[model samples]
Target: MTQVTIYTQNNCPPCTFVKNYLTAHHIAFEERNIANPTYRNEMIAHDAFATPFILLNDEPMYQVDMDKLNQTLGL
Candidate 1:
């Protein structure tokens, strides 16, 4: 199984969109709220400057490029 992690915050439409897209595609993912103190250092360590930052197998993916993402997942 592919491991996916998404860094997001509340009230972010793009974040929600990405989550929904993943769900619709039956992709399993873990969501981390960037606003949470527990994930703050992790986010910083990953150098995620934007909301909705995604990680695939511990590799930082900074944007929601659906085409590339789908291709990466072999979807």
Candidate 2:
């Protein structure tokens, strides 16, 4: 099973988009809000300084690259 993790920040439209996309597709994802220091640190650890940082099976996807996301998920 692929483990999906999404790093997001508050007041981010892209973050909402990603989350909605995943939900609409029935894909299970763990959302890590960057508002939390621990999650922010985790995002920084992945070298991502923006919202909608997605990790699919531990692979990182920065920003809202739907093409890359679809390809990765075999959609």
Candidate 3:
């Protein structure tokens, strides 16, 4: 199965929006709080400088472009 991971921070509207959107679409994803120290290295290693950084099948997606996401998911 393909894995999706979202790197996000607390109180970020876009992050919440994306999470809700994914859930509404019945897509399962792993949520990582960038505020957490445990994920700091992972975030840096992936070069994610912003919140709501999404990874689809291990590929980095810096911005949440809905159209692109839909196309990727064949939705």
**Model 3, stretches more than 4 Å misplaced?**
none
Q: Which candidate achieves the best TM-score against the true structure?
A: 1
Evaluated at residue 55, the lDDT of candidate 1 is 89
- lDDT per residue, candidate 2, 1-75, as tens digits? 678999988899998998898899888899999889999999999999988898989888886788888887677
Error of 1 at 65 (Å): 1.4
Against the hidden true structure, what lDDT does model 1 obtain?
0.88
Give the residue spans of candidate 1 off by over 4 A: none
Give the residue spans of candidate 2 off by over 4 A.
Answer: none
Superposed Cα deviation of residue 36, candidate 1 (Å): 1.2
Q: Please write out the lDDT profile of model 3 over residues 1-75, one tens digit for every residue.
A: 558899989999999999999899898889999888877568778888898888888888988888978877766
Instruction: After the best TM-score superposition of candidate 2, give how far the Cα of residue 12 lies from its true spot, in angstroms.
Output: 0.4
Pairs with backbone N, CA or C atoms under 3 Å apart (clashes), candidate 3? none
Q: What is the C-alpha lDDT of each candidate?
A: 0.88, 0.88, 0.86
Candidates ranked, most accurate by TM-score first: 1, 2, 3
